[model samples]
Target chain A: MNLGSLLDFTYLSFIDACKHSLYPYLPKRRSIQSDRVHLEAAVSWLMKSIDKVDGNGSSKAYRILNGWMPPYPETSGYIIETLLNLQDHYGDGKFFQAASKIGDWEISIQLEHGGFVGREIGVLSRPVIFNTGMVLLGLNALFDRTREKRYLDAGIRAGQFLVECLDENGCFVRNLHDHLIHTYNVRAAWALIQLGLLSGSRDFIEAGRKNVEWSLGQQLENGYFLHNHFRKGQKALTHSIGYVMRGILEAYLLLGEKRYLDCLKKTADKFVAIYGIRRRLVSELDENWKEVSSHLCLTGYAQIALNLLKLFKITKEERYLNTALHLIDDVKLQQPLNRRSEYFGGIKGSFPVYGRYAPLQFPNWAAKFFIDALLLKIEVMRDYENSLIDKLSLGRQ
Target chain B: MQELAKHHEVFAVFGKKGIWDHLDTYLRRRNEIDVHRRHTLAPLLPASHNAHAFPGPVNTLRFLRRLGIPCYKVSHLNGAASVDLLKRLKPDYGIAAVDHMLLPAVIDCFPTLLNAHYGNLPQVKGRDATEWSILLHDHLNVCLHEIVERMDAGRIYLKENIAVDKGDDFEILRAKCQDAAKSLYLRFFERPEECKNLYESNEDGKNYYLMNWELKALAQKKVERR
Candidate 1:
């Protein structure tokens, strides 16, 4: 069972879907019509489920779900991210204006609690840790876009909210839930770590440290969770491995703790061992893999692998870097050949086809992960250059 | 008879050795008729410089005693003891130059408590005497007036209009003013009673002014104008 091959196939399928679905949204030169169609379909699907409640009433379940989407602060953070990418490719102010609109929306939606409301309107609304985390990311993006202290202040507030919500043991409590345990804790932890690094706050750093420790304690000996109650036993399914791996990888990235990395590596190894890389590749086309075919999930695994490779380079550990490079190469190779129209530049299987699966659209989450992976690669390249210089100097000495 | 008249104790109060002592030396050289000419000059010293001593009234009183003159060598006396010392000294006349603070009326009215001002009467009355003249871009003489409750509003004992160069600073103008005032003092002493009522009665007619950074800047502009 070649798990690497399976991941590669999955990566290719996902990329094809993204590129095809997201194409129409991009410039004609960069258009992947199929990807754009898929993305639009997903957005439409999500929008349909959105509860358009009156300003006076409690929001519906639809609203709750829609509210959970990115650009939560109604700010142009997501838009800015898009614009930034586009600006790099094409120097244009239209993209900047789009980014600015999103930023304005974020500022408009800021809540009195120094945390943003989860939904547009709701009496049942309490501060959700995950929503706050997303808002923090958005505010950070806004700050980068504008270099305004107001955006920084908003980011700080969100970061502070996460810090304040930590329990004595450093774990974040998921509010208004029957069970306090949830993956939101991992995200909140990750957010705190990012905020700490950005603002140089000791409290945020300490909170992150605590949450990372709690996450480590939650992992089973098999490197898989028995069940993530928040996801409601979703981990028992085929896609569960990817979801939990995402959290683990995030924790590892945030803390840079060896245990988190070791835990993720062990889990990834198990996933590969069970599915086999070849079977995983076949699974991308398999009907059963449709639900998990999103580029976001695939990108998450790739990002972990890439980050681990970075860690390996620094530690001079061959296995870590090898595994990361292998995953990247395998994924690159398995990408669909004729995916010129996919949203994610040839990634497929993100969206439902004829109601069989989710659309192969460019989900904001997927775009974020894709961008994250690209940035990680760039960082790796830079590090490689530095390492080359060091090696040459050592040779001379 | 002249030496007998000069037998009365003479006291000279000054601060900052170089300029103050220089003025004192000129006076000493000029007042040759006085048989008993006493000078009391106290150098301005910070509190930290005399840590072992009380460094305030005690040191001042001690310095005054050491001078052996009836006059006090009070250093930095902006307090109650200065008034007490003035009452104790009960000198026939008190004079001040360079020290710009107004003495209390209780001390000012003590028979003769005259101050040497560097500006002419009815004009250039306040600070930056020569600089003010330059700023007004006027060629005028410098004069010395007695220190009254209203400053340059005091009765004018003697005055001399010395032409000042446009480039002169407060210090240079001050030196010239002091030299003129010293010479005036000698002349006034010769016939003190004559100029006793030299000032006009109406204080409103007197020019009162203050020197600050803005005025200094204006003075600089005038110099640049020249």
Candidate 2:
């Protein structure tokens, strides 16, 4: 944003460029730890990210220039699900308390119209469609756990706000990113579907389905989604692509319709084929699915890993699970473990920490998605273990 | 295999000798094919043609040639040459003796590609399945199935769960599994059409990867203790 920041970014970019050029020539130094270890470290990072905020919720990220950005309502809202999930996983009361506090903070910040403000707190006061949907995710999750009327009411309001944003064609015509429709908002559709299931509202479900169908129109035959970039006319990063895939997969989970899975397969199968050959996904891909950037979007990897694991669960396809494992293992390797550092346990937005996406920062969403992927990985592993153990028991003499 | 040749036009297509095959051959020459090679009597050891370990493609090829069956070797089953050869062969079905992953190119060459797995279908899959079956299920199984693109995932033709006796060790269990697998394969070949789609698709199965040394060791202990 500033000249100094630009110079700092330029210098880091130069260093990273050099590393990228020499990466293949250098001996591979990847060290992968156990999934449980990575999960613990990531949850700790999310807890620390939450702690950095004043009252509740989580900071947007720990920036290189600035210490910690302002608390982000959008990500912090969804982080409620992560914290509660951690509580269930570890049997710790602290995560539930933390999640509850975040939920309350989100409800307090809700606009009179029920939509959450765009960007981090204090940056803008205008309510946004995407942010409102994300907040609904946390609120609905909190309501599911505590069954509190307040959380339920907040969730319903947020869900209603999202429903209102949708036009007759199911596209969110208001508060779009850069005044352009983004395919990633299908995630909002996912949140709407969740809320619909929670509240048993047919309107929300229909609206959610309509939006998914609308998003499907944006998908090219090559599986690339149009208008998926942060800014119009730019190549879509794996992050937004992950968002699109995740939303469709979630819709399939709730609807139990083959069409949703078919929609996802258009994109997911292409990704699986490309990933099988390259072993890594480039940060950005053009409309033709060509690699346009060399940097690794760690958040995208985590998000896609979570989506792929879910796909595997549904299809029982070995490629999906294998690809998901590779993606998460790569993310696990990128995670920092220096306890004393502010960025400890946090996953960087980009592998080099200076890549175009979220340059020089570790975003909270990255850690959130990483934790989610790890949790899913654990479940998949448990299913595998249980299945094997069940089969083995038959051999008992 | 010799009996199959008498009934059907049986031939063997071996994957080009991998590093393990070369190593096995080298070890066999020095009389060090097994860890207990020096102590155990030669009569106690399984024959070279047995599925105890990598008997090397050369041994198998020699055996097939001796049986007067044609033999072909290829660097990769998915390679252009291999596919070209398969297209010419135009076999009704092809049997896979090794645990190699056949690509769609090779798979499309035949109506069905049969494989024998050392674990139960829609249950145990992937590497080290025999050890996993013993350690987790306390059972041993051998499945004969059609090989699709994905490893160990196909429509099973037969699944025989071999009883794991208290006195059985890894070697004894492996022997039983190999025997069962061989018998299943022959039975399928006897009535190929009847064996087709005998069992349902293994859609519920998960692809288990190679077990870690720690788990493998634990499995070994379990097998020996039993």
Candidate 3:
């Protein structure tokens, strides 16, 4: 941590300590606004993020000291869903246009082997499995919307690249993050499954299933997956955990596998239990499900909230919905309403914006997840209210 | 302890006590001063209406022991010693007296763990729930639910709506909630099966955090006006 960050850490710590005792004297922080308002602001920030990359893709992050960072193809690949959802929600043509541009840009950068590179664009690296799968998500979404042959072709190529990286054990060994097998590759597996469903390719579906099955083997009795972090022997960030969870959940949805649902529910139940008891979740957790880091990973909270919402849709469980709402509200508290600042509306990488995970930057993926959660929250609330109305109407009869 | 002991075998397990350093003392004193400074609302009520005082664990233990009820202290409720204590005792159920997050290690010991939340849940959760309920929803409630790992997202057994009658301040509302909680606890011990009606509160309700003084004052005014 830098001097400014150190000072920030100290100041935040002091404030937290004094908050309960000196509650009456402290400056009042603004409470959370409506979801619609936050959604609009977050979407605006995402557009600015895309604009920073010349409308080709989304920037990796917006640093406080530096300006906009380079475009990150991995995150930009999945951001297509957000844009398309926004288009459908607001009936805005521009969002669809932006989504198309992003999809096109991802296809433009696809390596000859059909895999996308890790990290920001312009980095000299081999095609990465996770990145390729992420891009394939956008391509598959675009093909589903438009039925464009190029998008389908590109998605197939990306799916093939991912399949090639997978070993006979259903684990991706080549082009892995840090060249180690990651349980989070289940997210890649989710994308491949989507591609398979979109193109009606049994081989892609089988590859996706194999990876999920292998990833499932890594799960401990307590529902925590080993080898979930970027580097081995490190505590897994809630970010990676969210990725692994959402992937498995998506796999469950597409493949119609009871085991996948059962596995995810076990883990989700564990997470819900911990979060319920403590009323707080740390950014990093060890395999034993103990807190290894005290900092709040804001991005992870958003991603997990999204995952919980999806879980609620599958199981119709109130606990999942309630937890997801709480997580979203927690993330919303971190969002600043300073419209004049350049970083306004963008979700910070960490609480206090100087914590361990992606410190000192407003990651584009964070904003992407925040937007997705907010949109889903609205949908969930509407469905619930509509169901209530329907029930009330039925009672009159 | 006196009230609970009348119906069921009562015991106490206080949270891990901490040694106060100079900074801790200072913070506590400063907190007291800050709270006293916000005494503008106190005089609005009658002088006889003193809010419930939260005696520390030592005092509480003394009070319980005076009543001839067993009292135990654990450094950490989730610690192995606490687990061993529960294993040895093997109580039918465990009821949390204070707001402490029990781990699965400790929770698994009891066939059923119970908690009385200060506000109607699924809607109002987290800190300052009573105040948030009054401020946001214009009413206060108490939820008696199973102690699940997920914060207040537990299977609610009973929801008793506390009337925010005119002249009720924050303290009175809180006292009412406590009384309601006591009644619910007694009901549970008398006929635990009646608490089996699962109240489905699955809708996504806002988990409120601390209420700022401005909002607190507004909620107070709402209470007084009601």
lDDT of 2 at A53: 88
lDDT of 1 by residue, A295-359 (tens): 23343344445455555554554334434543443333323334332222332223211111223
Worst 10 residues of 3 chain B by lDDT: B49-58
Better of 1 and 3 by lDDT: 3
Q: Which consecutive 10 residues in model 1 chain B have the weakest lDDT in total?
A: B33-42
Model 1 Cα lDDT, one tens digit per residue, B1-226: 1221265466544333355655554543332111122121112223443352212233443455465544444443444555566677677876665434555644553687666666545654654455555544345455556566764676666668765655654544554565566666666676677767564432433232333233355455544333
Q: Give the poorly placed runs of model 3, Cα more than 4 Å off.
A: A1-30, A389-397, B1-96, B101-226
Q: Which scores higher on DockQ, 1 or 2? A: 2
* TM-scores of chain B alone in all candidate structures, in the order given: 0.60, 0.81, 0.79
| A264-351: candidate 2 lDDT, tens digit per residue | 9878878776775465798999987889988889999999989988997888765576678768867876777767666778888886
- What is the C-alpha lDDT profile of model 3 across B109-166, one tens digit per residue? 8888888888868787666688867755656789888877766777777778998888
Q: Each model's TM-score, in the order given? A: 0.42, 0.67, 0.71
- Candidate 2 reaches a DockQ of 0.05
Rank the candidate models, highest TM-score first. Answer: 3, 2, 1
Q: State the weakest 10-residue window (summed lDDT) of model 1 chain A.
A: A56-65
lDDT tens string, model 3, A289-368? 99997777889999988999999888877567667877887787767677976777999887656677887788999999
